[model samples]
Target: MTTYSRRAPRTLLLALSAAAVASTLSAVPAATAATAVPTLTWEPCASTGGPTDQECAELPVPLDYRYPGGRQLTLAVSRLRSDRPEARRGTLLVIAGGPGSSGVQRLTQKAAALRKEMKGAYDIVSLDPRGVGGSTTASCGLDEGDRDLVTLRSWPAPDGGIADNLARSRRVADACARNGGAVLRSFTTANEVRDIDRFRQALGEEKLSAWGISYGTYVGAVYAQKFPRHTDRWVLDSSGDPDPSRVARGWLANMSAGADSRFPDFAAWAADPAREDAGLRLARRPEDVRAVVLGLAAELDRRPKASDRPGRPLTGNRLRQALQGALYSDSAFPQVARLIQQAQDPAATPVLTPDIAGALSDQVAAVTMGVVCNDVRWPAAPASSYARAVAADRVRYPLTAGMPVNVTPCAFWKGAPVEKPTRITGRGPSNILMVQSLRDPSTPYFGALRMREALGDRARLVTVEHGGHGVYLGNGNACGDREVTRFLTTGVRPGRDTYCAD
Candidate 1:
């Protein structure tokens, strides 16, 4: 199953006319011809969601560019003005990772970290994409049963069959089509990039520096390509493959390799005597830790165990999904180990994290699923094709099993993409900086390499010798964070690609 860090499927290549897409979307449409830029009425945020310094505002933009002034939607925006006004160069936009991450929430969570790194060189700002928190939203009216992470993720059945996943995909897709209406459909990456340009104009800023994480990285890359002159300093943190043909599909598949790559760190940690005090050690040897986990999961497959959550039992796929999610960071190792410990005890009740215990509300799930499905078209792959993929993935990658390759809501999604997914190239100015971990479970380093390659000399990759997704100001990678901080402040990047050791 995918982590909070999101993914998409397939690698169907399409060579979009970048010149055409760029020329068309670089600014507000001609339909709003000579429409004076709307001024912001910044006020104290109603919620204490962010820091005391954080202020909030609302921005209105066209619901659809084709009819620029016909109907409008408001984006919730936040700002942490530079503490050092004299040092302030410009505004820095923070792009949160999820197809569903609320930018306002991300800004609040990272305010302190960003405060220190930025040193008041730029005002930090973020906004909720439409259909997200504090912004206008839409719902699929999905049943609660279909909202669980395991169920929503398209995990195959206990017997390595995809029939259940296929059924769920069709059900979820149909529900969205029937209930999501227009707001949900608005949740595409292209739309978000367009929204950003509007935000820049509203701020009255000539150019913007940015830090785009996870899926936001794609948005930033597109924005840079579409409006090269408008980018002052751009940072793509924990980027996924920008393979136009596959987009999200490629990201989902890359995660399988990421899991394989990062699990060793967890296994070694679990086997260490250091974990004994925490009652977390699963085995005395690294390899045995893997064996124990695999064996336990396989055992659970045959007979599910009751968990602390009523009516929701711990199953094989749940355990695998937990493992995949936990492997995102070493800090989660204890929780998963504790889960294994509880599962091993016949009389003990297994504990579940909020993510595993509570399902996302229908509106939340819709927004998350919306961007992935709307960004690109999926193939009409038959069940037999998924079965083969599931069977093969289960045998080859036990850590992720076949979940990463299995069918999802996108396969049964209703609408064709509004536009062809943008094809990233070496066409932008050399103003991009990408920082990535060596082993990111959601967006792997190898995938980041493809993003780096797509940018050609337009970008530089700071390979952090660590494991986890979203590297800069994340994972405590001092080297990587320092490089990014330096670039944002001075506009100087590595002359050639480089690496940062743990």
Candidate 2:
């Protein structure tokens, strides 16, 4: 499905400094702090619409770890046992990205490929984090109108305004405050890290290896730091900076640079000869592609064209948002180009894909916004701050416009964090491996480098001179996949950081 998790924090724990994160590891509350988590009972999970070899189980943990004897959260976990028993040494946890992504589904989709690659050195396993997938669920009961991707992402309005976004921030914050309960509040990265350890305990493994992508990389880092001795080899793919000060807000704002870094690849592809026949070509030359896209966006802003949906025409910001998503992969370029070509026709109606065309479910919208807002305390600076930031960002990075810096629901969130966020550090074992795309549209190369710097001597990074959001197995970049697999199976890392040519 090419499922990408748009990845999130709080107060027992509020701001995580490197030293705090290091010291907290020694105090990670035991599995039986007050109530012991239940033993998992694995059963064939084929009926859940996943891979056949997958076994599923429910691992119960405290809904609020601080109150161990309170209500419980049943996380849905799955695993594909190693086929080569003699080579099996431990469990390889697949930490799927997204504050709302499903880890079981991720393991299902990649189980066959992962098993084939490492030749069964470990049992591949994953769990849907709290408030995600089959785990305990919660919703803000948001209106359908607020679930649109462009709106959800806080894309600035025409004229580079964020008034609408600010209002939306207030509206979403109100909805969550009114409806999102403890379950929603519990959707923080630190809790997910705690849950991973509970899963490890259920499996009876001494040390677990891990592969976390995007937001999952943050989860993996926290898990490694909080439970250093419990970790084996760990690989972080397409990571963003684990800046405890900003957390999700920092990652969201980083999209400006990330989109800028990746748009050229799409522009080059859009200008290809093959696109001419499809009437999807944007320009005769790559340089002109930007102007064409920007011009089209402005035109749409001036006069929104009729779309397939009644009374809901295609807006400029929506088109821009679609373009940003399309730039994530080369395969999606055609869809964005087709939309642009259709919009160019005054009489033609543009058809929106499911991802952009309609509103997501209330639960989806709530969780997506909830996790990020709950991760850390967003600045309550005056409206002028966001307005200025959006205006400046639009000028600096036209591809993303001002959406990256625009106000989000976090700005008006009512719930204060229960704990501080965890800071990634070089204090743990030097067993972490990071793989990054040189031209990633989402996480971007530069942010990943910042993460590399933060990890310092604790990690080795594999740089892929490629354009995409994910690496290892999915990108067909054999170099990235090889390095990650080697580290996972053989525990052998490059002596120093290295790069892999496209």
Each prediction's RMSD over C-alphas, in Å, is 7.1, 6.2
Name the runs in model 2 displaced over 4 angstroms: 1-32, 47-50
Q: What is the TM-score of each candidate against the true structure?
A: 0.93, 0.92
Highest TM-score against the true fold, candidate: 1
TM-score of 2: 0.92
- For model 1, the superposed segments whose C-alpha errors exceed 4 Å read 1-22, 25-34, 46-49
What does candidate 1's lDDT look like per residue over 376-468, in tens digits? Answer: 998769999989988998888888888889999999899898888999999968989999899889998889999999999999999999988
lDDT of 2 at 148: 83
Q: Positional deviation of 496 in candidate 1, in angstroms?
A: 0.9
Candidate 2 RMSD to the correct structure = 6.2
**lDDT of each prediction vs. the true structure?**
0.84, 0.82
Q: Highest lDDT: give the candidate number.
A: 1
Question: Candidate 2's residue-wise lDDT over 1-502, tens digit each?
Answer: 0111111011211222222223434454544253333567889887455567789999987777765567888899998988996777678999998778889989988877898887968888999888787888888887777788888898887888888888888998998988988888888888888788767765766578899988999999888878887788999999998889998898888989998888988889999988888888988999889999999999999999878988678889888888888877777889989998899877788987556788877777777787888889999889999999988998999888888888888988886887788878889889999999998888988789989998999999999988988788877688988999888888889999999998
